[model samples]
Target: MFLKSVFLVYSLLVLRVYAANIMGLSPFKMSVIQPLLSSSKNSQIDCDHHSVKSSKRWDVVDMLKAMAKIDSTVGYEYEVMHWLRDVLEEQGMTVEMQLVEDEHQSVTGLARHNIYAYMGKTRDTSIVVSSHIDTNPEGNIPYHEIGEEIHVRGACDAKGPAAGQIVAFFELWDASIIKEGDVSLLFVIGEEYNGIGMKTAVESLNATWSKAAIFGEPTENKLSKGHKGNFRFDVEAWGKKSHSGYPELGFSAIEFYLRKANTLLNAELPYSPVLGPTTVNIGTIHGGVAANIIPDYVKAEMYIRVADDIEKVKAYVEELFNTEHSQMTIVQYLKPQYLSFDVPGFELIACAYATDIPYFESIDVKKYLYGPGSISVAHTQAEFVTVTDLYDSVIGYKNLITYNL
Candidate 1:
């Protein structure tokens, strides 16, 4: 106990030095700063100690609503990232806007960034709380409240959980339950599409020694057991074009593409009892120029949620699509990802969606997935999360951090 107390004091002194660097103060000046966890600033605080006073507060629902109003679709996440950086800076945390354009080409011609932040400017942290800030482009709804529920794009998918994480960090800091270098926050873009944002972060972030990480996604406030893998491909075919009247003279590209698609729809794919069945989705199709004209080109995009081995799924797809009339191109592929859910009292769930967790497979960290809301309504026009869920998730995240630390 004596050694532990001595180490705690040493850690606080080191944190003060790092804080001085971030606040542009000399080490001597930072040392003279008021006591930690002053009750005068936050009279509402319930921590054990009491000292000075301050007035700074944050809310999960407000943060969620603010982010939901912004359109941070896959390729256009600069504005949302900027907003989060400002919020983190306001809390006196050291923030780094890690550029992600080099990894994935931005469609908006604007720079993309991943927010990497830590209190007191300490690069190394024991725990990391991360979530994506991007949403699908189809439903970019503005912030609006429907009674106890808040309806908006990215509200349930991730922004709500991200907001909860931010608030949880603040509460922990305020109560002095967690101090400098104990935890870090990372919010990345491009998760709805290719996961380029997190891919970039795992390659360059300074937290190599982190022991555990919590990823925020829609899990209905339960701890995720694992999630299905992904295998996406595009099928393209070409045929001669002619007028509708000359039916015999031209070939129908759409018809040919549909035949190939039917072959896949009827094929039997692998499944597992734990992760469930592998699912397929024919996402998009584009080919015809006009109703009267026979189409010269056709293309169909397909995605698979692989519950079985991704290699086996990929091999089956490759052999099935091998033909002269059509060409198949693989877009994205990832194996199923399993996560740690040993925390007692939390319900366990397996998701059918893919996340950025696979990108960190090589890292040795206890990865966990937990957040508020349901994935069923995430990408739809009905996307939303309740105010109760948002508040619950703040506590959920705080529990996970406290347990891990």
Candidate 2:
């Protein structure tokens, strides 16, 4: 135990000194790295303290575990951003924090930041690797290993991919494979919610930073050829409220909402030969104050996976849900995104989930989606990724970056 603590403390000190010397920052006065080092009791020496001297297969496992332990759900990505900034800076990379505050914060009341890093001071690069630093709103699950599989919230969804990307950058830097402004790493926030972080990045950052981009998501180590788009909307029904004993005097909002919801759900939607049939999910429904009283208002939140054109899907919904006593308000929508798998030797598949891919449409760069773990178990209590898969992705990401370079 003592030896491990000594190693942990020593690694941080060495990194602090190296970062200070490289970035011209003040020498070691306790930074964000200290908190992570002290909190991560099981953290291993993934990289050499002085320099990147090792590229062990399981180096990312400990790091991923530590990152998964941090609760960076949706609006709460500030701490994770700070930790990633410190790590990147310590590795002699230039880091910046882009605040993603806008009108949305009035409701969430929490401001989040995105971490962007690159070699040297220049922002221009030939290749870029990116991933979301935030997970779903589900509370943080304790990190634990069950045989080769590790169970933890955000393990498969993104933190696992994020950790792999970080290590891949380190490996590339250590081997001198990439130089100043050769590549950039972008970790965005709010991908699980509204994709505001990515929008802000695209709007604020230099669009010409890179010619190619590698986006990390849970693709089961496969390179995605395409992924379905999405549209979110809410259905609200209003009715007269009255006592249940005299039900004839009042109309039930819940009953009206159910009827509309059922009709809309039963309607046939668009389909695609490659992306499959358009699907809809009634994610949430809330109404009624008590069983004895008729509910005056009811709302149902719905999400649609767009396998076909986004406009067609919207038209179908708007046409089908037209009614007198109900209102259908569109919340958010993203067109189905397609990408190239031109790089040889990778398995290709289509994903149903939406990512921040579409937001970069204006960049005019070749986009590739690749990562470790399975999306099948991403948001559930059983969310997990195997140590083997996580480590393999580290090498995979390094190779992808090499290809772009």
Candidate 3:
């Protein structure tokens, strides 16, 4: 037992020396020694720590975990915004809130606010790091840890990038590298929906002088050169209601909708060499009151990921819906956006998803989209972002800020 104890002590001494070399700490320092000796008995010491002493640096994982705990789905972003505002204020940054009126106030009964933080008054040449603060409502599930990956609703879709941006901003602030009004962080809401938060911010903030903007979205750590635009509409078919048993007495709205939707699905959509072909999704369909009654009014919401000019696609859709019995209403239309970046050591790729880039087009700033995580799992139940990816994104964002500055 005594020999075993001696061997254990020797191993610990060797590890302590290695940790001191890596962490650049004095091995004999009391702060280091006390923690090392008590670490065996202390539950506070994490097994993976280089030594018993806890690092004072801000942890991206901890911050992400904190942010993930708050439910920030669409219209329900008040709690997360409050938490972010407090954290930014504690970091000595000037924080401001842009109140966004909820269009569904009668249904949700919740107010929405966009949070913006910066060191000083905005400057004309400032660099902006931005990301959405909300996740898809369907995926607001609890976060869980699996190995080095964190599984959560918004872990990859946005919250991960948001946390990374915050950490990068904090690091820049700590290093005194960025002056007041040199760099800013903008966390907007409702990107998962119609981008109302960004639209509100652009008009209200009047930040046209900003030279560059770095948007955070899941790109698996690569930079996005361009992304597809979005166009949404609902096709509603109306017909006379009749008993299901009656064959030719009344037209079936469901049949009419199916024929139109099939025609659209089979039609050759405009294709782009970079963004590929325009895609359509029959997201939701509703019509009949019962199985026994014919559906008098049938409606199907369709979303098109447009790869061509938005107007061209809109015109094509209108042409497709020109039938006398059918009608289409435009829901949302955002033009395809192209981004540019000169950051070294990163591969550039194209994204098929839409972002808030369209809303910021009025500012005339060079925009770049980059972040950790993959888009494949963004809105899925198994959404996740690796710890390494999250940590690396902090450096990525910092590099972007440094380059812009």
Report the C-alpha lDDT of model 1 over 1-405, residue by residue, as the tens digit: 999999988888887776444332345643434344423532322121122122345567656765666678888787678767866886778999999894346667888999999988687899989999989887567656789889888988899999999999999999999999899999998888888889889998756646889999999999999999988889888888999899689988888888878887888888878789999999999999999998889998999999988898888878766666778898778789888998888999999998889988988899999999999989898999999999999999999999988
Local distance difference test scores for all models: 0.82, 0.79, 0.80
Q: Give the least accurate 10-residue stretch of model 1, judged by summed lDDT.
A: 45-54
Model 3, span 1-405: residue lDDT tens: 999999999987877776554333455531334243223532222222312333244478766766776678887787678768866776677888888875365146777888888876653337888999899877556657889999988898798999999999889878999888788888999888788889988888755445789999999999898899989888988887888899478888888889888888998888889888889999999998888888788888899999887787788789877577789998778999888868898878899999999987877778999999999988888899999999999999999889888
lDDT top scorer? 1
Better of 1 and 2 by TM-score: 2
Q: Please count the clashing residue pairs in each candidate, in the order shown.
A: 4, 0, 0
For each candidate in turn, the TM-score is: 0.83, 0.84, 0.84
Checking candidate 1 for backbone clashes, the offending pairs are 40-52, 40-53, 41-53, 41-54
Stretches > 4 Å off in candidate 1? 1-55, 102-105, 244-248
Candidate 2 regions with alpha-carbon error over 4 angstroms = 1-58, 102-109
lDDT of 2 by residue, 49-100 (tens): 2122212322587568656766787887766677667666766778888878
Q: List ranges where model 3 is wrong by over 4 Å.
A: 1-57, 102-106, 123-125
